[model samples]
Target: MLGALLWGVVAASSLTLGALLALGRRWSDRVIGGVLAFGAGALISSVAFELSEEGTRTAGPLPVAIGLAVGALSFYLATRALERIGRRGGGGTAGLPLALGALLDGVPEQAVLGIGIASGEGVSIALLVAIFVSNLPEGIGSASDLLKAGRSRRVVLGLWLAVSVACALATIGGYGAAQVAGPGFSGVVDGFAAGALLVMLVDSMIPEAREKAGEIAGLLTVLGFAVGAGLSVLG
Candidate 1:
């Protein structure tokens, strides 16, 4: 449990780092987009190799399928709801969905970390690094937008900090769930996270990256995927 907590914190620490960077300087849309592309690539590898593969291996096809469907639907609905709320809250809260999006993304990833540890697989270096790298752009982009929307620095930083704590606890929760569940059940959990993550990439990460980076974003995404996959292979 302690190990899981530590690993979760290490992965999520990048959120704070990105927030700090956002507070320090205004980054160009192109730079932010490039970072988003790279992170999106890393997340793609994680979902494909780390989460989905392991999920299928642990439980087989049916559970993974069910988990995937549920995860995707849940995220879609939740994001839509957040968007509605943001719209109602006025232009100043445009970043609310983005901030919530980051939190939503982190939950499943951190939970998977705990699940892996509890399953006796220990920590997945590839997954951890992917989440960490992905989170930086999320934090920076979201924080910058929030600041632009007139959010105070304290509120922006506080939001990231709060989410960080939640993610750490989520890791512990996953570990506990594993203790009480079978391999098949844990596989479902893993699949669920992967499903949610993939949807998130499509819904926000990829689009946001593309909007900023243009055609070059594709190449950068591939590069990011290669880097993430290499790390997975090395690990």
Candidate 2:
């Protein structure tokens, strides 16, 4: 449990780090977009090698398939709800959607981390790096938008800090839950995370990256995927 908690914190710390970096200086859209593209690619690798493959190995395909469909739908509905709320609230809260995305993405990702720990598989270095890498762009982009929208630095920092704490705690929660759940549960959890991540990538990250960075984003994404896949192979 302690190990899971610590690993979670380590993974989530990048959020704070990215927030600080964003607050410290202005980043060009190209740079931010490039980072997002790279992160998206890394996440894809994680979904493929870490989550889906492992889930299939652990508990076959049925539970994972159900989990995938459920998770994808859940994320879509939740994101739409958040968008509606943000629209009603006005443009002053432009950053809310991205922040919400980060929260939604973080929870299951870290939960799966905890599940891995409970399964005695130790920490997956590939997944950890992917999560950390992906979170950086989320923090940076969200904080930057919030600041541009005239939010106080304190509020932006506080929001991300809260998100970080919540995500970190999820790791502990997942670890505890996995201890009592059947083995099939881990596969479901893995599929759930993968589904959410896939939706997020398509819905927001990829399009945004392309809009900001142009065609170069594609190359960066492929490069990021290769790097993540290499790490998984080595691990």
The TM-scores of all predictions, comma-separated, are 0.93, 0.94
State the lDDT at 234 in candidate 2: 77
lDDT of 2 by residue, 1-235 (tens): 9999999999999988889999999988899889888888888898899889988998889878877887788789988887777678775545665677677768878988898899798998878888898789888877887898889899999999999999999999889999899878878877887888888889878888898889999999998898889888976
Please list all clashing residue pairs in model 1, or write none if there are none.
none
TM-score (C-alpha, index-matched) for candidate 1: 0.93
| Clash count per candidate | 0, 0
> Which ten contiguous residues of candidate 2 have the minimum total lDDT?
91-100
Off by over 4 Å in 1: none
Candidate 1 lDDT tens digits, 1-235:
8999999889889988988999999988899889889888887888788778878888897888887888788778888887777678764444555566567657767888898999788888878887888788788888887887788999899998998889878899889888988777766776777777788789777888899989999999999899889888876
